[model samples]
Target: MQTMKLTIAGKGEGDDAPLVEDLIGQLGDFLGLLREVEDAVAEPGEENEIVWRVTGATRNSPLSIEITAFPKRHGMNIDQRERKVRAAAAHGLAEIKRAPARPDWFDDRALTKAGGIFGRVSNGLAATTIDFGNDLPPVVITSETARAAAANIVRIQKPVDRPYRELGSVEGYFEGFERDGFGRLVLRLRARLTNETAKCILQGQAAAAFEERSVGEVIERGRRLVVSGTLHHRGPGRLYQVDADRLQLLRNSGLPDVADITDPGFTGGLRSEDFLAGMRDAGSA
Candidate 1:
């Protein structure tokens, strides 16, 4: 468990307190920043669930709220994880304060979510500060600092295009089954190598094979599946979908590797290379 303090200082109307809407907006952005940071720092396959509570509040001139964040799951190293989360939160805030300058650790998504903090200052949020205890200095965002940070966030360059490419075969847990708006079944697979969820769209034989098993059987057991398809992605580690032409359940003793297969009529008598080339040409057409 760890405690942090958030203080919002400004003059509103005739009082030395910030506006209610401004205060609420800042608080929301602050929570969002922490959540993004937590997600960015979490290890693969490990979900960090933090429960935040308002432990105390001060009615002083500059309203200050004490928030305690603790992990929901119990473990031997809970304290260590809490500390790491706190540190990450502090680091994320620091990066935001130095905005227009690239973040040293946070990804684009995290930076985008936290970037709103800088814009709040222009909306009459005089100043916001986050204090993480234990000899660590608080991160303060004033009107001047916020303007600079916000400018930097706006100036950051973004990629022009994020495209999908061919990813022949991928193995992962196939879960999250639902119907799309067009009344088509969509199965989401979290790939083992990438850990990114790929929406699996079954085709031909793949669709027929999936109908053999009940949805309950597939989801409850989290069936591992090998899906050969085209992978849509923006870049490395950013897989979005898979248009699968082949889908098969993986057994304890998995199926033989492609190299071990001796079938010459794998793709209706066409050689593997020629079949793949034809598919690519069809896709481009």
Candidate 2:
């Protein structure tokens, strides 16, 4: 709680400062006891401190005791701090009863970890919620809590099926290439089908062939070319590239054409110029 004002019965005629200081000293003793209780009950890394505001004391006949509390950084669970304050308050009240001369009138406000002391004024005591600062609300996630959430998430397995088939000469525009850690080149291309365009990846020897024919021209200019190879697989989605081997580029000079070549199956080591001509003829027929 940022500020707690207690109505300590002061010897009205005497110096009010000394009386407030004495009451503050007594409160500090109570805090020491509260600390012990907190240490036993609170989780590790939790901390708290007490402060007496000397200037906050009333100069008038009836004195006011103002004290403040500050807790160390913690997780988002604000309720924990509120619980600690309640426990501390209960403990402090118990100690006050043991005092030989307890304050005739006092404030019993429910202090919060976020520096808030809230209560309605009753019997000459002005208690209310104290707003310390504009700090945003906390994100409550302990290590254990995070681990539990992770454990509850569902995982999907990757699909696997492999039986090589002829994918014939596929026509597409070259996008780019990336060499993996294993020294194997990966070619990314936009394969234009009869009805739709598919993003394709040519790996290993097929990718090497394209690199050799183009002299890595595709990597620099990103040209559109025709590639012929054996289709290893179509992958999970039909949109996946037809994994091919023994690949050959049909048209290395970035050209867009409506080469009507139906799934001509796997064309291992086929020449691009001849394949393009045959496909063009087939389209005419």
- Top candidate, metric TM-score: 1
Worst 10 residues of 1 by lDDT: 153-162
Worst 10 residues of 2 by lDDT: 111-120
* lDDT of the structure predicted as candidate 2: 0.40
Clashes counted in candidate 2 amount to 3
Candidate 1, residues 43-103, lDDT tens digits: the string is 4345767766789999797899898876576643566656766787687567656644445
What are the per-residue Cα lDDT tens digits for candidate 2 across 1-69?
A: 334444434333454232444445434543443344444343323344332233365645445545554
Model 2 clashing residue pairs (backbone): 166-266, 168-265, 250-272
Deviation in Å, model 1, residue 247 alpha carbon = 27
TM-score of every prediction relative to native: 0.53, 0.26
- Which stretches of candidate 1 lie above 4 Å from their native place? 74-77, 157-285
